[model samples]
Target: MPTGVALHDVRGQLFDAAERVLVREGPSALTSRAVTLEAGCAKGVLHRHFADFDDFLAELVRDRVARIDGHAAALRESAGTGTVTDNLTRVLPDLFDPVAVAVVSLVTSRDGLRARLREARPVGVPILTDAATAIASYLTAERELGRIAEDADVGTLAPTLIGAAHMLFADRQGVPPEAEDIGKVVNAVIAGVR
Candidate 1:
């Protein structure tokens, strides 16, 4: 940021900056001041745009959750271009990125933040739940095309796969699960039911 230069905030810029701060420095480092500094804007910019820091943080979490939902729902984007397993394996990685992991950790540990988020979205759609639902819908579509077994229990399998994914990468101390690891898990889950 050049001295005295006015930098306009593009939508999501502050959110991206906050995510970066969380990933690099941890949740305690994510203040509105830090985000504005990272975003190269005035400190008051965040307050001006949002009711307060909690509202802004909730929005960021909401945005990431929505992004995950969008990504899960876009399973068809790879339809016909790759095997069903391949498409699902690709989408699975989006759930375990460092930024997302940090956000999840931060939100779950803070009751106030959690309450703010729930208030912001009254329907109380958990991101993981939405991801599982979207994954099931995709699997159902594939099953319709004979990719999955007709008797496959999609409802049970969806969350099982998602839960497996969460366990594999949600651990902060371990090395993040690689694509091969995710592929093995996805294959096993699909094979057991499909």
Candidate 2:
């Protein structure tokens, strides 16, 4: 086994490699062996960092949720300056990234994995809900500022837009929307709010 890096660094690398594996090969390819190999670490490295596959999976979900939450928070902070459509367009792609989609796909999959994923639900839900709230708040502020349609139902509309963004990428058979397509959707939603 090769070793030189600090334990925390090694652990971080393994988690990042796990995300790549999950995104590129789906949840089935997320074994400790695969992650260690991808990270160029010794076999025991994964064991040292994670209790077992279940713990590793939970951490992966947690990390992804944290990343999404951070990104959403950043978007909310910058939202005030952009047009409502601009703000939605900026944040939409982050929702559709391969890692994020893979996490959701894994959660909806069969028995054992689904059960393990359920254990992380309490961790994941609030992150997403907070993201939704940030989006809704941005829209509400825009509406108040006379930038968005005065009558726009910011509450329902914001989440629906976020859901649609996720659906575009999650639907495997369907073509995902491009930036322009997303802009169109945001525009339509705004129009409806008007």
lDDT of 2 by residue, 23-85 (tens): 778866777788888888887878777887667767776777778666766766765585767
TM-score of each: 0.83, 0.78
lDDT of 1 by residue, 26-77 (tens): 8877787899899888777778789888888888887888888668657855
TM-score of 1: 0.83
In angstroms, the error of model 2 at 183 is 0.9
Give lDDT for model 2. Answer: 0.71
Sum up the clashes in candidate 2.
0
Worst 10 residues of 2 by lDDT: 120-129
Q: Best by TM-score, which number?
A: 1
Clashing pairs in 2: none
